[model samples]
Target: MSIAIVDARGWQNTLDLKTGEKIDAAGPVIKLVKDVLQRHPYPGDTDPGSNRWVSDTAFDLIDRYAPRFVFLTYAAQYFSGRYTPMSKETRARMISDVFLEAERFINRSGFAAIAVGTGDMTPLLGFIDVTRLDGLAVCTHWSTRYAGLYGPSPDDMKILEEHPHIEKIVSQEEVVRLFDGTPEQTLRLPEYLMLAREGYAFKTISDAMRIPVMIPSLNFNVPLHAPGHTVEAITGIRQILEEDLSEKNVALIAIEGVGLDEFLWPHRPCRNSTEWYYYEPGEAQYLTIVSGRHRFLDYPTGSGYKYFNGAEGAARSYPFSGHFKSIPEGAFASTFPGKSIAVGNKSMFMHMVTGADLSVECFARNLYNQGTMAVIHRADKL
Candidate 1:
């Protein structure tokens, strides 16, 4: 299949110092998105503005193309204050604003079968029929990193359980069982998993902050199948995708950092993970939805794609393997017979996670104004 990939990373970034800081060129997708939203702000200004730009762009894409399946990942909440120096309260306010603005656009976007990252948005989106819980957060015992790998110390484990933020402590063995058992070396899953209580996320021994965080949860009614968990929801999303897409559209909006506490969409109580099961890198989490299988490829440090199968070059992407041999089978988009599009601001994620026909992601280079690019299949790298 010939899929069109559009990268919208630096759409608002237009400064070229060599050219006297002139505004950069805007791509067709950016132009279209800007036209619909009726506002354009440099994404670097604030966390809410960055996320809203991405979310609004996704809404506009769906409205314009009316594709069969739409997958969106919003990243500002996760990226904003975590790395940069910002007060915790300021970060929290920015996230709230992003969600609030997203709620307004999603309701008016006109798609009926919408799935979001949290149960918090479910009630507000009266038109939504299905929901999935994501961004679930858990407290980790960093000091026990090496010790827990072998087997957590009984005394240390007991101490971890006493923490006020901890709801339950899941051990390495228990975590292995959760993903149906993976070789510990392959994924290097966390050793001592400290599941956090609602309204709290573990930061440091001195600081367990009460903030919105996420951990992976059971894939109940979601479109993709997760290997170990039972689909408790009445209608599975896989069935819905294949059956309904013949006559309608489905939107899967993944709010990256906002979990149940932050995104709270009022979903029926479903199972959350005992601890994070994927590799430490954030991209691994997407595999649960895209491939619906275990972590077959192991990434060393940065991106899975960068090191996988010796795919080299600065771009860090490979061809569309179509689950034929290169990657895991049953990738959602690889199976789709119709047009599917994935759009997100997270670098290299849209193409890596969903094998959508047309994948659009924020340009990794410049977040300010450079603009989006399309990913096309070459004999070698993307």
Candidate 2:
């Protein structure tokens, strides 16, 4: 019933500053996020680094925003680009180091923190015991929804016809075997099952350790595409949370942020450039405060995975491109049948939902616009 928008700017960027910048004496490094939120980045994006002076007083600002919990995010700056490409062992070590550093900052700040793990964290998180933290999110592979690709192929997507794309990928028998180390799942094609094994191995190990793992999925991204869709998606999310809370020890919801080339931007290049379902700013508040963890809560925007909720029907997304475009008046056209187009292009829903994006900017719609309508509970208006 409590929450605070914690920025996980990764670990490295915490101290690294722009030239001529002085690190504001030691403290939680969320001042930049605070300034961007409190003071409009109006007149274009304000270099938050310039406001390093605010880190010293971040706690004061947090006190003013007073909510329930906080998200201890790892900043990306040099870390993401620099290390995201390293081997699992290397990335895991870096992630673990970041975890230790993050804990120190969170303790110093006096806030109950939830761990948001993405990027090179899957197998690595399994290496640590996360139950000691307020919460931990075992983020699955970013490209898993593509049936295991940043963009999956028809063959890869076949099995998911019966399950949510992510569920199908992570829950694969092969993946499950890898999690427990067995040869039973060899029945499935090696290519399809191999990539998933990594994530499933991580999730399985993390869960085995009884770490408070938050399950993230493209499913929760449903709420932001349209008002009507948002209503239904929110209802589904609440239902999932309420059920888990009632049936389980702690309930968590994983809704991703929807944004322009958001942080999880193509961890590795794929066959085609594609983005997936994530929660935008205002969107995460409802789910986070209400249920559990949604990746990139700080990012603003998302797509949905309705199959996870059940009863997925025909729906439309923003339709940016790649879902079969119009000829545009004499543009060279293909003979792909119109009848088959509707049914054949069903995949477009996923693209539009995630790849397209929220029609409005979250900065204008959520951060700047204040009212009773908010995903996470806002503090008393100063």
Candidate 3:
């Protein structure tokens, strides 16, 4: 079979077949996807309907094919409350409720191995067989006194170094050196990277409170944030797919905005470590996981990157030029020799990131009500 892409972002596009006719003619997998989309027909990313789309689509896919590798993104609840003004306690509980529901599904669903995010990768080994990889020690930072927005002044940088919440400050040059990344990766990177202490998160100098990254204790022999135990999104996930999923079904799900304290099922299998880079604007993180590289390697973030990057842009339904590179490769989807599929409510991500054999995501324009669309790769067509 070949790679198939399902885009369920907008209302039924101008197609020859009526919506009902299309669903009837489609294969069972595609039919089931449309059914789920219709059931939870809401149109916004933060809406309950969107979250239901994520959970329902995942459950249906698992029951039908039990695909060996499954990746899901459940962030609606996190998105709903992280930025809203509310009491810290009230806000924490709001997010926790959402995590609990998702965790409940994981506990009940019997997968051979599972890995949850917002922590280091090795901790997942406690639940399954896996290897650790290098994760940057990323912290959210904001100026305590200065009103700096973009780049901090040299004098302000000095004060930032001594800020109570600051752990260590870094520059784009330092980031490249630290990660062994190419200079291109540092483009548009914050002028001064102010890392937060283990228990802290920072907002922009002018913004209000920021959420700190939290990971479960997992009761590891060493502390959760212990040095050398941390894992980043890109390599950590690659290791899981390579080493953990050995001829058995595996699920790698990420519940955004839920930190350590908010993770409902800490007692369940998983590990704890810091998310090294910016976790919000999650499209970047998803790309990092699917590509096994930092997003910066491809210039122009998000779907825009698809236009210039040969590996990502190839096979997309939209028009693109493969100028920067030839014979495109790098995305795991491009190389994986298996019948894999990805389904999630995150728009434009399944194809952009995993490029799985069959990838499905919310339709960006209409999101809800409109049925999903599918993309079948010429090489791996079913």
Best model per TM-score: 3
- Over the stretch 163-243, how does candidate 1's per-residue lDDT look in tens digits? 554556555566556655647443544444454443333443221322222322222222322223334332243445555
TM-score of every prediction relative to native: 0.53, 0.29, 0.57
Which regions of candidate 3 deviate over 4 angstroms?
Answer: 1-10, 14-40, 63-66, 83-97, 103-109, 119-171, 183-234, 267-281, 291-296, 299-334, 364-382
Q: Give one digit per residue, the lDDT tens place, for model 3 in 35-93.
A: 54455444566565666566667676566555567666665654454334456686667
* 173: Cα error in model 3, Å: 2.8
- How high is the CA lDDT of each candidate model? 0.44, 0.25, 0.44
**Model 2 lDDT, residue 50, Cα:** 15
Local accuracy of candidate 2 as per-residue lDDT tens digits, 1-382 = 1112212222112221112122333223243233433342221111222112122223333444432222222232222322234564754454444434544545555533222222222222122121232222232222222222223456435543343212334333443343333343222112332122223322311232223222223222232211111222332433332333333222121112212123221221111111223232222233332332332212112211101212534453212222122211110001111100000001112111211110001111111212110011111222
Off by over 4 Å in 1: 1-47, 84-92, 116-240, 243-247, 269-281, 296-329, 365-371, 376-382
Candidate scoring better on lDDT of 2 and 3: 3
Query: How many residue pairs clash in model 2?
Result: 32
Candidate with maximal lDDT: 3
RMSD versus native structure for model 2: 20.3
